[model samples]
Target: MKIKLNQLDILLEVAAQGSIGKAAKALHLTQPAISKTIQEMEAEIGMPILQRSSRGVTLNEYGQVLLRHARDIDRSLHQARDEIDNLLGKAMRQLRVGFTSAASYGPFTNTLIQFQARYPGVKLIVMEGRPQQIHDALENQRLDIAVITTANHTSQNSMYYESLYALSNTVIAGNQHPVTHTTSLKNLMDYPWLDWDEPGEHSILGQVFRRYNLPLPQNIIHCSSPWIMARMMEQTHAVSMWTSVRLRFPGYSPNLRPLVLREVLPASSIGILCPNIARLSTAGNTFMEMLRINTRDWLQDSDALEMVVRV
Candidate 1:
């Protein structure tokens, strides 16, 4: 059988948990699938790895043998990989990261600029895509890391990732919108509110409106891109809600000033998104750490990120 290491990891978890249900829950797999794998392994080895009964399941004697050896195999393999990575040296390793279009041009670039200065050998491959695309690439193992907008309810429900850093608490309006002083969402609710996120209404704006017990305003302007939104704001009284990080972009001009929301809009977090799996290689790990540390410091000092733009 072409059993892979990931499958083996499942095997180990199932054995330790002593229950297929718990193992599946822990690994985010279906119960039957986990059971089938264990059974298939037993059949391939010509030994009962699990003793099943009404009470639950227990690993059999031969299963113990396999477990011990499997653990050693995993340890040795990991050590070998670490040694090889070390031998390759810093410059040889690669870092493939994906980011939202804005982040690809924004913080993602800043993080890399700093990473490059320290680890010049590391090659960076960057992609700009939608949030869904970013999630897909990471889940498919096509990307080592990504900067995604967690506003997608589907993504939040899937728990496909964990956070690295974020920018919370923001208010946004187009750069040239006539109404400039927007402290509370209530101020702009009656105006031409841009309906950028249409169908789901599950965006950060949705949560904010819902929390205040205010129905979403029907008057809408549906357009994507903060740049486009900014332009729309420039011509009309229309305004679009967005997080502060969107303004942090070098492209965001003094003209597009996002007034802080007074009713306390939900904080929007922008950060590095790692897949549910283990972290990347040593170089990737180092880069991720740099992101967390740097992002925290970046938000603290937006001036530093601006400096990256100048460089």
Candidate 2:
């Protein structure tokens, strides 16, 4: 009933380090002291939290349940500290954001400029990753927000999802590539295909091939980094699919051109994903406000895709 914050910290450290001895060393306490803290925590909860093993200690079912709450508490405490720092005019306020490569195209960059202008005191940390990796970071409290593509407007319990722009997926190739002149998806199969490292038939190109009952491209090079993909597209005659929004960015490679295709590919929307339970800091809320304002026109133009199916 009277469990302390230090007790939860010990539990987390032990679980992270996987043994009492390691946790004790990491926390600058003796093994007995770490064991005593864990024992006190278990006594308060009236159950064994960790399972002992010959190799190492692991979290039992009870410990696993408590670990989730412990992490939540730790996140809440950090948020509280950040809020206080912002309120007291401290310069240590920081916001961590994760984004996919496509999400960094136009609107995201514009919002970052505006956010930095408004909140110069706050430090901004940005990371680019796959959609699933970004989502996992958001769930683990490692990131304050995420910008990524959402296939549909489905609801999630742990995170808030908002679709800002429904972008058309366009087939792109080097300007001198022979496939750029072809309008049919079947014709594209002749050349090497450049695509993301997504598994199975989940990619937009895969879906397009499946829609037309065409066999997937045999000569495929899968790369996860968009920058590297762009480089590969420019140097080689490989065809790839990318969002139209990415093409609008001023920094995009000039060697790449969107192919005018006869087949309509599915549309994916870019959006913001943030934790539902953790209230954003003042700086975080301000950045979101700036993002929402900057993307107002994009939301209205979401229906402006020329050769894409609205999904």
Candidate 3:
């Protein structure tokens, strides 16, 4: 029998669980294989590593010493990989950026475009999802950065948000809808209304519903798609509630006007969010800068209210 570092790792897991059966299950190995490996390890080390009982196994002094060193080695190995990856530019070779569907309509899109233009050598992968979904992906190491709103999760990792632009919540209705001509909410109450009835756990737009409880007309369009919802806004006299960003999309709000609803609809801020990983690749940091600059222009540009910024 020969002592080996790999066998030592298996020994550590077995010691922590106090049973070969449990360690086998955790490591996807057979209990006999673990037992044989540990037996061989004991033979090489010339020391008893465990004491068995009907209930389970317990590590003796030799096992404790081995386990401590195993853990330290495991941690050092991972830290070394992360450090070497940074030194060799693993971060810049590829990237996956995530954004909410709403952001795809503007800022996020622009940032990716600029990032592509500037770092053509780097591969870019983009994913469109809800804020919470994106946040979860980032936390799990599935995404590099996710542009999300406050209702979404925040991370303890190095995270930063540049609130580059804000969208004004406004009243919306189809072009021919009778209420489109009405100047105030009082006059608009006469028609069937379409509302952005949020489903599931998404409550980002609940504020708009609170101020205006007009019975949502029977013919309402509750959706998760900004593109489909915008088109629906133009068809039926269904009065839709949306942030000012929707108006600027090609098919939305071009001819629509903000409803003078009874109460003011609060605006939502959109930003570029970055996780402070020990290192952000040169391309990633540069993309972030481009996003900020692009959004600043869109936020200040009213002539073309809805602006799409592609990253």
Model 1's lDDT to the true fold? Answer: 0.66
**What stretches of model 3 exceed 4 Å from their correct place?**
1-89, 105-107, 149-159, 181-201, 211-220, 253-257, 275-281, 297-311
In model 3, state the lDDT of residue 104: 62
How high is the lDDT of residue 7 in model 2?
A: 84
RMSD of 2: 11.8
lDDT of 1 by residue, 1-311 (tens): 56667667777887778888998777667798898888778788888888888877887898888788778877887788677667754324777888875455344667889888887767878887666667778778788777765553234433345454444445555565556554667767888876445635445566778889988777876655667877676667776666545666666666566675667555444556666544257766777777767566655565544322210
* Model 3: residue 272 alpha-carbon error in angstroms: 2.4
TM-score to true structure, per model: 0.64, 0.63, 0.58
TM-score of candidate 2 on Cα atoms, chains taken together: 0.63
Local accuracy of candidate 3 as per-residue lDDT tens digits, 232-284:
65666656666665666675557566666656555655666665422455556
In angstroms, give how far residue 243 of model 1 lies from its true place. Answer: 1.7
Give the Å shift of residue 71 in candidate 1.
2.0
RMSD of each: 6.8, 11.8, 12.3
Candidates, ranked, TM-score? 1, 2, 3
The full ranking of all candidates by lDDT, starting with the best, is 2, 1, 3
